[model samples]
Target: MNLFPDAVEELRLRTREFIRTTVIPNEPAPGERLNPAVRTELRAAAKAAGVFAPHVAKEFGGQGLDIAHWSPVFQEAGYSIIGAVALNCMAPDEGNMHMLELIATPAQVERYLRPLAAGEVRSCFGMTEPHPGAGSDPDALRTTARKVAGGWMIDGEKRFISGAAGAGFCIVMARNDAEDDHLAGATMLLVDMDNPGVRIGREIHAIDRAIDGGHPHVHFEGCFVPDDAVLGKPGEGFRYAQARLAPARLTHCMRWLGLARRAHDIALDRTERRELFGSPMRELGIAQNMLAESVIDIETSDAIITKTAALLAIGERAGSSLSSVAKVHVSDAVFRVIDRSIQLCGGDGVTDRLPLAGYLNEVRPFRIYDGANETHKWAIARRASSNRRREVEQGEPYRADVDAPR
Candidate 1:
């Protein structure tokens, strides 16, 4: 992660310019996903701008940025809703790409990671499922993969699968029937979307529409894949998931923080032009307070993203719990920034004319996405309690798992 200081800064500035000049103009009306034609055009523009796939390895046609370096560049990409897509760093795809690079074999890298990082195809992560299945608690995952002679037979259904509809493939997580328990029995597999037994159900119309490949319901009935389809190992799905989520959640925070900044910028502009009772609206006490609070929110969010990113760069899974901390705080902070922006902008903010409402719609789910804030709070408290108990028993400062690779 010790990239040249100058290069990272230059990339960040270029990304900011690229987002403003290229992606935002072409951004579809608020609450709508980009059409294929527009997406293709923006990606080309991103490639020309030298900002595409900044997180992927350079050997794979990307800039080869590590976790720490990704913070500034990714936040810049977040400035516009379409910015991440243009740069080929959007979710499911970006997160899946990270996971692929971590465990994909040379051949798998060529078949999947290469095409995905190059923007030649799209992919989805199949973990979240319908109620009673895996959601906030992944241990409850119901998708099962039964052992077969040459491979596996995967079954069960998945809901809220981002990029499921038009994705080229799915990185699926399924419980190995032989494991007999919910804990360590799950496995990760790469499932081609065109497999005969794979069934894509109706799309789930969620609040965030800017996201491509609208979240859809998916089913796998006896879907079979050969031995090589297993991602890392038969029973280490949760570890790989932790490996994927720690950084993925932070990247989400980075991108949304940029969107929150966008909302704040929009509000600040309104304040300048607005006048009330023959006095400048910007001079009002509450107005000034809102602006100052948003500044605080933005700065603090950036600080947390930086802290978590640094922990992840040196030790891949080191930030697991800290990422939960980042997720809960960043998500809530960004939402408040957006909400305050809406309040500052007055009536126009709620209308489609301004993107504040759309920003709210997109960010509101973030509190629940990547695991709910309450769930994260519970996990944080449990970890703290466990750490305290160990600290007392050992009669030493129990630094906990933050430095250890989870």
Candidate 2:
């Protein structure tokens, strides 16, 4: 039986058409490309085609697709690295939209959220910081937002911030009060990127060349914001950030799955025709094995992502546990698939003659963003242990214990 409804299939077909016709034609050659402008044109086309922001609510000029239905649509967009950009569903912006919709006050919504959802402005999250600041551990955040007259002053440096260069505003995280008992004492403030105290320090060259609003090293030199700049409540920053991350990571998995499929398709096409020692490459045992593994990985990734999306739609707060598992599995799977694709292509794979080299470079960061594989594994294991301990204490049989030797 099909898990998804008829609407999902219809949406998938529509999105596939959009991707094949509208998106693919616009992609620039490997070496010749520009920033923001290329993305702008694509966004306009997506808007005109009525496929922009598939996940955002319909009231906000989006399709308002549910999580289950949106997963396939996002996967289709992932087929082309630039597809998400064209559809206005790219990162930082996509995650930022979710946060603003959930927490922004009416005034904040009017000022920031509305423009963002309308695709009139670009934004970024200023969370990840350099060494000695918040990196993997958000609790280590050292950026401070000191209460001042009618507002607050934020001071800190944010590194590896995507979309910082062209962002009209930034959602900044900073320590609110040291006395709070919360594990991670922080607050999120929406700071105008144009503020004198806020500086775009430098652009960080990333492996992915298609990225617009380039990732940059940012410095918040006593940046000031009115009291209303706070998103949600104080001391709730970490909670809100984590909430945004779960869905964001799922979307990343969905997109990368498509990318991996694209790479595998390319490799499969090449192998079918290429002669190897008087035989077709597809006849080679190693080539066949790689292709089979790629197909399995992509299919598995799709199943996990769709199920996770259903969990989120039901308001279950699926958490990092499932998302982390998906992250590690999908990232590693996609990387491997792309690596094998490149290997199959031989010298052409590593060269700019084809897209495999760029695809390989792009998929590499999927392992790090959202949450690194190692960190998520540790968190998942701890959560599993805690659940098992609780179950045993309550005289309930733990699944692991049931399978364990006395």
Model 1 agreement with the true structure over 1-406: per-residue lDDT tens digits: 4444888988998999989987888888876778899999989888888999999999998998888889899989999988888899999899999999989999999999999999999999999999999999999999998877899899999998988888999999999895545435789999999999899998888888767788899999989999899999888999899999988999999999999989999989999999988899999999999999999999998888898898888894547789999999899999999999999888898998898899888889888878889999999999999888888798874456765557
- Regions of model 2 farther than 4 Å from truth: 31-35, 179-184, 397-406
Mark the regions of model 1 whose C-alpha exceeds 4 Å error after superposition: 1-4, 179-184, 396-406
After best superposition, candidate 1 residue 192: deviation in angstroms? 0.5
- Per-candidate TM-scores read 0.95, 0.94
Q: Backbone collision count in every prediction?
A: 0, 0
Candidate 2 Cα RMSD after full superposition onto the native fold (Å): 2.3
